[model samples]
Target: MIAHLADIESMEKSFRTNLINHLTGGKAVHLIGTYNEHHQSNLAIFSNVIHIGAYPAMIGVLFRPIGENSHTYKNIQANKQFTLNQIPLSMVQQAHQTSARYPFGTSEFEACEIEEETIPEFDGPFVKHSLIKMGLIWEEEHLIKSNQTVLLVGKIQYISIEDSILLPDGHIDLGLAQSLSAGGLDTYYQLNQLTQFPYAKVLADASHEPRRNS
Candidate 1:
């Protein structure tokens, strides 16, 4: 179970990839939707979507290098917009199938039988069944020199959350929404909240301890 850099590098490609990807534990799984000028929609599942900031409401998705087969990336580049749809537990199979290499210009939404919708001004399509969805505007990209993977950053322009999961204080209960999480390439997980703690601050004195729950 112990692996050093040399050990990881010497492992089989697939094994190494799975090990490294799963090492990060559970990650937010989302279906990224985009379209070109002709309205040729593209939908793909991504686990690398991460929150970059909140003040301006920015998110970032890591793409595995730019290539001719990167239809999602191409669509985002063409329109500078995209949508992130949280994969529900019941639709994991359909969401995961979006990763398949479909032909160029083919709509994964159609191929996978997942429903899609559009916002008033957003060009990207959203998953109709997704309880949480976000529309974003492409802002910038950074290249990871070591592997050439591109970190594409986008600013959140719109967000839609199902009423059941939205808490009064702005916290989202993913368990209530039945949101699906990912661990590695194909494995999916269901999240359950264990507890919530108050924001940490400097202790008043040595005798004081942080509260266990909020």
Candidate 2:
């Protein structure tokens, strides 16, 4: 199982990709919805979304090198607005289908038969099927010199969470929502909360740590 850079580079392309992607374990999966200047909608599944900050409420999505085929990237670039929609377990197949290489201007929402929804004042469409949705404005982007991938950051402008999953303390329970997560590129997993802990503070004796199955 030991693999160095040479060993990894020598592996088959698919194997290398899968190995590297899976090494990160489960990743949050969402359908990024965007719109072009023509007002055409585009929806694509992305697992590279990450929380950038809470103070400014920013998120980042890593996109492959911008190219003619990068419809989502182009749409976000053109409109500066996008939506991230969480995929529920029931819609895993439909969400994955959004990754297909449909021609430019062909809406994946329609091609995949997923309903599209819009909120007041937002330019991008949201997934009507998703229980958790967020509308964001493009804040900035950076190109990764090593890989040529683009890290596009967005500021959260609006968010909708299913009422039942919203906790009293503000945590969203993914298990209650039945949200689906991607293991790598193709594998899907269901989430279940294992435990919760209070804000960490170092103690003199270090004897007050919360214990589960103790």
Candidate 3:
């Protein structure tokens, strides 16, 4: 089970890729929707989305190498707008199929037979089956010189979620939405809430150290 750097490099390419990807644990699964100047829509699945800041409501997603013909990246570059739709447990199959490469100008929404929906003012289409969705405006792109991966930052301009899952304190219960998660490139999982903890604060008399379950 112990894999060193040298061991990883010597492993089979596909096996090494899956091992490294799974080493990061579970990641948010989303369908990034975009459109070119001609209004042709593209949908692709991504797992590297992460929160950047709350004040500006920014998020970042890692796109593969710049040399790759990424429809989602190109569309975002062209229009500076995109939508992030949470993949629901019910639509995991269709959502995963979006990663397949189709001909240029082909709509994955149509190719995968998934329903596409859009808000009145939104620029890109959103997955109709998703329980939570976000419309974002591209802010900037940062290139990782080591790996050639592009990190795209975006500001959240709009959000839509089912009212039943909204909490009084502004948090959405993702478990209620049946949001899907990924372990690596292919495995999908359903999320479940374990426990909720209150905000932590150190005590004046003694340090408030967290208790270990074991």
- TM-scores of all predicted structures: 0.93, 0.94, 0.94
- The alpha-carbon deviation from the true structure for residue 17 of candidate 2, after best TM-score superposition, in angstroms, is 1.0
* Model 1 Cα shift for residue 92 (angstroms): 0.5
Cα shift from native, residue 152, model 2 (Å): 0.4
What lDDT tens digits, residue by residue, belong to model 3 across residues 101-161? 8877999999998899977978788999888999999999899999999999999999998
C-alpha lDDT score of every prediction, in listed order: 0.92, 0.92, 0.91
Error of 2 at 59 (Å): 0.3
lDDT of 1 by residue, 1-214 (tens): 8888899889999998888899899998999999977898889999999999998999999999898799888888889999999998889999999999999989999999999897786768999999999999999999999999999999999999999999999999988988877999989999989998999887767566666896
Question: Between which residue pairs do clashes occur in model 2?
Answer: none
Off by over 4 Å in 3: 205-214
Tens-place lDDT per residue, model 2, 1-214, is: 8989899989999988888899989998999999878998999999999999998999999999887799999888888999999997888898999999999999999999999998786778999979899999999999999989999999999999989999998999988898887888899999998999998878778877588895
